[model samples]
Target: MKWQLAGSLGLLLALALVNVQVDVKGYTRSLATRVLGALTSPTSHFTDLETSETSDDEDAEISDTSETENSDTSETESLETSESEDLETSETESSEMSETEVSESGVYNYEGTEPLDLTQKLMDSANKKEEVRNTAGSEYCLSEDDDPYTGFATMTPYRIASTPLKADDVIPAGCKPVQIWHLIRHGSHGAHRNDYIKFEDELPHLRRRIFRARVHWKGQLCEKDLELIKLWKVSKMMSKTGNLSKEGVEEIAGLASRFKSVFPGLLEKKFSIKRHPGDGNKIAFGTGSQNHQSAVAYISRMYDAYARYVPVGSQPSKTLQFYDYCRNYIEGVLNMDKKLKPYHTFMSGGIMNSVLQSVSERLGFPVTVANVRVMYNACRYYYAWYRNKVSPWCTVFTPKQLKVLEYWEDLRVYHDQGHRFEINSKQACVLGKDLMDQFRNRVENGNTELYAASYFVNPEALVTFITLLGLFNDEEPLNEFYVPKTRMWKTSQFAGFGSNLAIMLSSCVDDSFWVSALLNEKPVQLPGCDSSLGCPWNSFIQYYDYLSDCNFDELCGSFSSQLAQSRHWYASYMNEQWM
Candidate 1:
């Protein structure tokens, strides 16, 4: 009876074990089938899963088969191990794919491109170039020394207009240039009176120091440099200060001749030359001085005897000197000294002092801030005088130091004269109104009376006018000027010596008037005007009308009041802080 019971229990146990083995084998087969499907799937969805799961599939299968052939315990253990390993491989692959997918895309990604190391590039470029000689190549030639001040916006000289007006090509298929308003700045001139005065005040002391220090310095003071210092006569050099030089005349004449060449039809004819009528009808040669000189230079080149000159004085034409009467600009100037105090502090700091010291060491002299200023003036004059060639004096400062100096100058120009303050542009409304009036007259009178109108003005006035006119699209609003180091308005582009802004009114076959602007003799599109063919006359009129509504007196008063309020607030803050 005991043997029968034991045999029955053993049979039951064997049956249960067989069932368990079958269940385990079924589970393993199911898992393997799913993994194999994932591996073989064509879709990207299963690619990573397949790659990872399939990697160990052969090994897992081989182990499973070997264990299955041996004993049930080993097969079960091996199956469990393979399952765990497969899961871990899938997880690892998923993590790696997540990171790699970003870089796997076929298209080129500029955002992912590495930034260039500018310093390394500069070093490499310097290494590639041949060594530059210390002296000037020829007697008439300028020194080979790189002008550190070359990148300064104001320091840039007039380049030949890159995009010359191909009148036949640029003008619309059926249009003709009828009336041209050539508003230009005086050509390249000698140093300003202030610059000349500074040079005169500092040069003697600088020369004496150079002579004294020459003994201490060995190779620094070359014979050529010594000769240059000795021969530099401040009196003779300064005689042309504030007056246009021969080069200035040539610059204006060349510009005028270029204009004639571009628009032969408009300039070749006997066009009535109209100027602002404050200086009387006769061409006043010596009255307005530099402006008159510029006008004469243009007239002599373009008209000869064909055109009549209407002399205009500086008094009656608010269009040209609109900022002079602007109370807003005057107040801005008054407050500017306070605003610019930080820049002055920066200029007087260790960085500038170091530059001065370095320059002194190089020249075998003691250079002060005042002396540096004089040197920069001399550099500017010689650069222009030699026809866009760099001067030896420009070598006094390094590129980095010159960049700092340029920013300082830029800050002053921006705050005082440029579009940094809103009032600067508002003062240009008078000029805008004048332009509108002239255009209206031409449209109404059928271009018979006024053929060409020229206004010779200062660079600041031209800048203001162009800013208000929305001629260049590259400028940001006045309010945002303080935020960024990126300057869209460049002095070189807008206010360079002999910079001219020409507005040509063309009559198309459709009887529509089109307007386009020529900046420094290059044709430029008007900002607000849409058509590439040319802006519609009506659109131009609307734009001008919108600008003309800015009442000059109201703006001036508002600006003055705001400045006064700011001053009061500042004073109160200071008093409170003290308390």
Candidate 2:
């Protein structure tokens, strides 16, 4: 073993003395040096061998260090030479990114340095449409040109406010408008099912009679008059049955835009156009389809976008047709067609019959009372549909005949919807209480987020509610108007298409909340109110306290039973005196 070990040691020493070339992916020195050092020092002490091996490893590491340093030096010089090019490329990329950002941000820096006249562009577009000039010559035919109540209950489109409210007019002295409660009636719609049916039944016969009359009075009936009679068609009118006309949609949209413009501070930011999930702003619409459509159009115009806030549709029992659920109203007013018997009898009697005959003679036709009613309806509808243009049918009746017809129409509305019975006004109590509750809640939490509250309803509901509000100013006047004596409660003022009643809650200088009422966009004073700014909040609350406790479900149930039990309910109601 000693001889073999000596021989191996000699071989290793020979290898170590001579330089051995080993290719180890260019790392050739470390392994060869370690082996050579270990073998060449075999006879030396183990500590000496370890020291020699460590020395060899250190020398190999030094050589590697020198190569790495040279490579690093070359890399540093190359990076320094390309630095300016790299910086230029970065700057170009950054400039391109900035331009992209500016384009995305929609900020246009004009070369001319002149601001764009957006308002003038809008005016030019409007002028191109020629809406005002076109509307100028479109005047509705009326018995009297001076008559302000031309539209009556079938509301014609008209301007609500000529000018917008100034800042002082809305905000008032030290008072800030916290909450706005608006009850808007749906826009102008076509006749109901019953009225449409009546028109269909009577129009064909009336048209035939007019044709015969045209032949009877050859020269007296002008070509225009004959053409008007020929143009009268039931199908065109029936197409819009119980739905809002295009003009009606326009009317509602215009009204909403006007309201937004008038109260920008209340409606701008931090306000919701419709009811949202969180408790902030609430806008409600009645369950009626017409009301919903009106709400959509109004919101679209108000926001200048598709309506974002989903509207809360009030229950029909609670808001839309509340009168139908009211026990007293359904039993006493709606079922009581007999109470209006006197007015109906008088209207169908010799006085009105003579007026009808006179109208027929003027038209050179033998016209019945039914035909005359149809003609009057045509006058009203055509006037409204034409967007305030007078219908040719209006020329058929003289001014005196129109007055008689107006009075007869008033009687019908008075008995059915007006103050003929106590229940008519009381039916509005439920809605009144709702308004009061909203106002009270906002007033109690004046610092809270509840800013605007809106309600949409039908025209009939609005009329009844306004009547309950004592809009006529005197009960005696209401009675006199019911007697077919005067036109105190004009339908144009109370229940027109897109009609609105706004109750503004303003904080006063004395730290009290004041309530103001605006009817059809015209400021009006309540009974106790001295000015148009309206009465105290307490008084407003007191005026509607009776309705606060009304149980809608109970009232509806009671009325349903009463209507079921009485076979002669209509007859019984007619006998009862007007309250």
Candidate 3:
């Protein structure tokens, strides 16, 4: 036993030297960890000898010396309380996943060289496709070009200050614009009421803990970020929580200005571009105010004067305010357990565990997943709401950590809004039918009743409409249990504040009307109707979910959901649910 002890100590010393001398790809550091385990139980006789089988690199990584890109490891606060065995099992699963997860899922580089995209990375991880996201990375962030605010998923702001869409020039050469229909999400606004309360109550304690843990943060975080973190405080907006913000108003103004510049003749007062499409609800519920105000602000620049009155929220049930009327979607998806299961599953997974651990170490403190979650929220909201200013909280996380959290938000959105049956067919069809109605009046009948229309609503309705149009659906459905390192369903791009879907009906010299579509000002081909000039009038209408199958009252009825589930159109989705 004495001889065994001496040999083990000598081996440990050798391993330590190797660890110190060679910082080779984290593999050497892992080998030392195995040796340390043996020393803790010398009687085991160094049984963990095989390098391939015994390397546990994904262990307690919140220590000062262990925080690195290759030192990716576990440790997390479960979003919910669970038994000890369950927690242990989750940690174990996360470790295994780290070993097998893909090599390059398109990371956000902190060095400020990556294209500045507000949406998180959307890689097709299942089949290894190129990361797909908005490429308009020119001068959005005031200073740091590589800020990871782009990965905040739904929280990312619409890129208003960047490249203009120039909607007029985008129409195919021979086509003349006849009519346009636009649907926009509400612009940026103050944080949620709950967010304010949580920051006031919870973040202060976390803040002090961060200062106490700063000794451990040496070399982990930069000094400038550290100073800002110490000075950080919850905004005084607490006195009036959830109000429309100045930035949101600016976003709206930018939208109005862009709309006018892109299509001066189309958006004239003679057209149907109303004064304000914002909801009349109180600031707490009136998300439309920010962009609506900003858009109103930009009107002076766009035109000599604006035009007519259309009462916001006055459209038919499930047409403008579909969220309020879609009882099945509200009860089943928003209020029930089904839509959030994927988010909850992802929150408790290995990637999140490592994220929690990484964030904690990166900040020089031990933080619960809840703590990191709040910080992340604050970071995103602040970064998005204030374009010219960078949030202190945003400095707490790296691009990798931001990406993981973004994926968490993506998972929630996928289940709730993206590619869901109700969203694809019922919730989405209300607006789909409305837009098609306008198209038919101009093209098929040449009724000439309307020319252009714009409406603003919440992101929920906007994202669902995008799904109905098949703008960003991935070939592989998102699984709650396993995250695809890359996939196409990205909410940040699809439903950011001020994000919109626009369809233009144009008159071609051939005496046939054609339709073209744009998302966030960029022209894109619809799934079946792929054309540069515009798809034929008939082809575009096929995207709509006909009113015959989607009566507002019937689709919202409890009994109708059962019958709707059995429809041939939903057969594959039903099978997928079981699968």
Candidate 4:
């Protein structure tokens, strides 16, 4: 008896040890979660209350990296992008407690720091990071030692970059999940033709400057990193500029797999319904091919059948892609000086100036802010596309610097796609109407043919949808004034590529239906969603009820324009007149 008791105690102690939590990539989690994951197969009978399974899915996410266009209008993109307006990455999350009403109040991480002295002696010492590994030609990935992902807006690899949900946070108990509605953006795509051009054309001159410059950079950058930078070769993938990368296909595949595992009943093959372009070519640059490929990659993996799906066209309907028809916005942003003023102001602020000066001094060259921006672009795009690899350019910044850059990207997105204008959010009501309709069907009729509806669109539409639904509304609007580090509108988490907003309908024993919101696989409470029971079915439906018969022209005040932003797949590529 004593022997048995001793063994039991030993086992209990071991379990306790296993339960101790550890922090990973800015997220706090218990090792017990891993222990549970080890014991559970995601494919096994899924319960609405439990899904604590982990795969070699190295993602805090499931992230690992991170766009395009083709049109007659003369293309003129620069370091300052029109946000994700032209980003073509197959790219772009978080777990529990992800949304916290950030539009009004939150702590911004940035402050005006003293400018770096151009004459100050350069140095690289103990402050230089100890880790240095060049992953240019390697397939290596998911190092626990790697720094937490610094979100890079739409360029972010959604899953691999964000933390996962606590298993139990999926759905509340006594709630039987009946259906799922998912709105997904395309996965991390290839670099823009412009960025690719700059990487090939402009970066070499900067590299030569670094190589020939006379100064001490050893203190800021380790020798190995510097060497790797010097030896850096532009990726051959750049040749396929403005299309989805292979990594992007993998992201969609992984998402499809995990979604099924998390809600097996809702996502089963018989219940699955996918609506996206059927083109096999990987779309970017207004081709529906990339979007189609994304849907194929997702559905094929989910059902284990590629040929089952027939061909379809891209989602060019003005309802979801309404930005094309909105004349005020299309014309307003045309004035680069006026449209990008807030972003440009932030970019040229004292804080940004400090960052530019510091990076230039570190490399011992006359690097411009544009150069730093490009280096940042290289780091995010490369890391996003090659989840298993780190970029040599990634070594350029310290953690603090990464945060500053992240905020910079966020500020740009804030104005372009976020709460800057109610018009943007108003345009999203069409999507909101579609989502609530699914839940309403299950509630009113009581489980009519199991439903899993997945729609794919670009980030421009996705962000507007998020805005309309008030998913990440912050207390303070993002501006050149400061960085809201604690805010919910952080695009890296809110709008990453492959990012999704899932609204699930669960039926209760009490004869009521409730809906739960999951943003990029993490549980989040939408404006008035219950902390536990999620949101009541009626409440969910009422929010979008106003869109019963909404019209895009009426919403935008019958606006019309001939200016082609080349942002709309249908309007730009297919020759749809917005008027």
Candidate 5:
């Protein structure tokens, strides 16, 4: 027993030493040698071996040390590996962040003395045979020197200050005038308003009633229209329907409130939305009525807002229509997807491409390789423009649609001047390509102050005016495209609401200043006006100060406060129900 104890203690000592050696060396070769030494260490120790019989306590203590050393070594190795991995990941993320920051800064510095040729070689390898260009319905007036249109001469910025804010100019008095309008149509057929909630409980009886009402008016309403109205009424009552459903009571109340907000005095005086559209209209109880209701809701709220600022001397004669008016509105909303589909690769490239190609090929202009290429470029350019610009379906302006576009633009400018929709004002400015081009030209020619001041007559009012209207300078183009009468120059669509919103929150301002102000839960300050073009207008810090100093924040606060109060208007009425 004594010999066995002594032998075990010796073995433990050797193992402990080997473990310590391996840990210290930290090399594969050293570890192999130590492991081998441990294995080969004495197996037999008998005659004359000066071994001491260790106590059970001493042997146990030595074994514990051996275990502790190995455990420490393993833990240390694991920590080192984990730390290395973390370092690698951190380095990678840091590199990516640096790249992003550089790109956002928009600084391009070439190291070489002579400018190097930079071209996209991969673009050449695109399916040449599949390329197609369609320019049939379009007219191109390229410049003599092949320069792109800049919209410089045609698009000049008008100073907002030049037009005085006359209290009487905002609204046309009694402008009960009927502007060309549109509406959202109702569902095809359905149960009456009161019977919707009780549909499932008494469907058989309700069906009989609906069958009677629909049958009697079948010819007038059309079968599909009747069926749709029935379904809608049911869905609306069940809270399953989406927009413009059969929840007429609640919807009508919202309409009423919106109207009240817009036409403060009209509801009680000469005209009520409910009575004005209902009298003498065939749609008093039908889909026509639904359409009229929508139009009334829009005009009611809109005009009321308009009247707050403008006071016309005389009320304008208003005309009302039912079917056509409603049809146009519904069509615009429905066509949104139709308009945007052509821009998506999945929609335009995948789905519509085959049809377009086949149609073009069959139409005798068999999309030749060159034509295909041009068409592809045109399509690509159009899609890029759509993605980067404004809403695709929100009316575009060209020669044919120019008048309507102008009216909308003028309305936008007028509305913006009144600060009704400040969020949309800047986007409207961008649509004025003519204004941007001229400003950019002036800036490039070293007249930054004059260029910015050119936007308005009084430079002092620039900040407040911009804040009130949400206008910015980005509406101008950086590159030139060609216009027929002029040299090649860049152009801006500066037409749509979405675009107006974007420029109002453009990056030209301080670090997310406009967006922050517009979206802030609390009221912030407005951006301040700049007297000097060199006042670091583009600097984030400078812009932040301007925004903070101008009290624009308070103005936005007022607007948001109004919107919040309107939420109650959307609720169904209990005190006053309109039959």
Candidate 6:
């Protein structure tokens, strides 16, 4: 019986020691407090570091004495002192915490500090961040890395120099044709890119919490933002559709003006203003996947600027899908014949919308009907409702195309005012005919351009060749016909696919072909053609049609007086008869 009591006492002493160890280690001791009763089940202990089991009142009374004795154990006393020392060391290691920092209630116990449960605080922060990311996830923007695409206006200088061929130029080489001209396409629209956006308080308000999560709160370069930026860059650079940008507008317009400068009255002579020539050869042009169509679209938009008025929501004429089909067919025909492939590929409203939506989505906006329609109409209004959406306006000069066309119209109607070089009524009629002919050529040749060539050839062939051709690559002569003021720098330098093709043709046929020379920058004569012959060669290469269109009796009458009557005298006689 004494041994049993002694064993019980030793067990109590062990329990007391365990309680001390647990306390020193900062572990829970509720189990030790209840040891006078039944022990916690192994399963329960496994389930939790600490667990509770009901103890009888009798057992509880026994435990009270055990607890008192435990408090008095030498080991327990030593553990208490050691624990205090450990706590002091821990506090020293974490001494940066300000007094009253992170309060239990979470409210600042002091002006700028409060205590908090670190784990709970971390979890709360994470949740807030997740919420923010989800909220602003829908906006689209371009990143700094994305390349910018300008308008069609950017392409006009090259178009004027390279003079794309027209569809009528497809006739067999053996055929005796007077002249042929054409326009060609370069290529398709560029893809979209990742972009960045600046947001205002109002926009954020509209987006509400979503915007905050996705954009504002997250800041730039966050993982989510980076993902969006990457998506945009890939989509834009690889986009299969859409017109050129504002720069393209200027490109086409500049080309038109340069065309006028190069082939003065080309349109008038083509239309048969001189009694509508009966045997006039056709002019041709071609389009490609997105280029020519975009050109048309660009032109239409440019013309809209001159409209007296435009309907509020009506979209400006942009490229259509059918235009793209037609352009592709034109390119195919040109390619098959090996005559001169014209570029094809124009945009339609659908294509443009698709492009816009794609870009918007990549940027995170996912273009909606409301936003898309609004943007289309707005662009149309801005472009003047020219409505020719087939051509990609993103290249350049589309605006100038509008201006020059308007100028041509004014010149056609009022020829007596010396609007463009003095000419008699007959000369006026002849010029008008030329304009009509050019227009008809475009219409007859499936709405393409003459002198413009389309092909599956490399776009940079001409430009690259010329750039490497000569010793210095350039030479200069003062006021010389084929000389550029800056000296020769490079050759075969054309801007786009159409421009490159034009350069290729001109290079083959013209003797003074300097790659660096601007095709439209100076007046150059074709090889074997003399200035004394009253024929002038200019920057843009001309096909038979272009020359034929300019061969007017009134305009040429003074060249060889013995062979023709004075155009002025003839005009006077005709006018007198009418009077």
Off by over 4 Å in 4: 1-145, 165-168, 214-219, 270-288, 310-318, 333-340, 445-450, 542-549, 557-579
lDDT of 5 by residue, 376-495 (tens): 222222222222221111111122222222222232232222233333222222223333343333333533222111010111122213433343333332111111232111112222
Clash pairs for candidate 3: 118-150, 119-150, 123-486, 123-487, 125-486, 249-294, 252-294, 252-295, 253-294, 253-295
Q: Candidate 1 residues 1-579, lDDT tens each?
A: 999999999999999977865765455445543553343223442233234334633223333445335644553455456445554443344323211111222111224444333223333333332122123212211243443346545545565322455675447778888877777877767676556655665555455445434322211444455555544555445356447777778778888788789888876653334433222112222223567778777777766554344333444244465565565576555345453544455556665677677666666556676677777767666665666544546645555556556655555455556655667677878767666767777786664556577778776687777767754334554231232356565565667677778788888899888887777766666766775445778887766676647677776654355543452332343223211
Better of 3 and 6 by lDDT: 3
Q: What is the TM-score of each candidate against the true structure?
A: 0.62, 0.65, 0.65, 0.67, 0.17, 0.28
List model 4 lDDT by residue over 1-579, tens digit each.
999999999999987655532222112112222322233222222221122212212211322223112211212232113212211110111123322221112211223432222111011211121222122212222222365556677678875554564435757678777777777887878776666766765555554445433121122455455555655666433556546788888878888788778676555534234433222212221235556678777767776754365343455445556677676665554233543557777767888888877676566555677788778888888787776665667766666677788888776666767888767677776677676565666677664553666777778788888887777777877778677659877788868778888777777788888778788878878776657337777876666566555566676555434444445433232111210
Q: Could you list the CA RMSD of all candidates, in the order they appear? A: 27.3, 37.3, 18.3, 26.8, 31.9, 25.6
**Residue-wise C-alpha lDDT for candidate 2, range 248-359, written one tens digit per residue:** 7887788777777777766665434553432455666665567777777777786664356544454433465676556666655665565354555755577777887676
Number of clashing residue pairs, candidate 2: 7
Stretches off by above 4 angstroms in model 6 are 1-254, 261-270, 273-287, 291-516, 519-579
Q: For model 3, what is the error of residue 325's alpha carbon versus the real structure, in angstroms, after optimal superposition?
A: 1.9
Per-residue error (Å), model 4, residue 266:
1.5
Instruction: Summarize candidate 3's per-residue lDDT along 189-275 as a digit string, tens digits.
Output: 777656666666666556544543432112244545655565555543332443456666666667767776677666654433443
Which pairs of residues collide in candidate 1? Answer: 279-313
Q: How close is candidate 6 to the true structure, as a TM-score?
A: 0.28
Worst 10 residues of 1 by lDDT: 99-108
Full-model lDDT, candidate 3 = 0.57
Error of 3 at 164 (Å): 2.5
Which scores higher on lDDT, 2 or 3?
Answer: 2
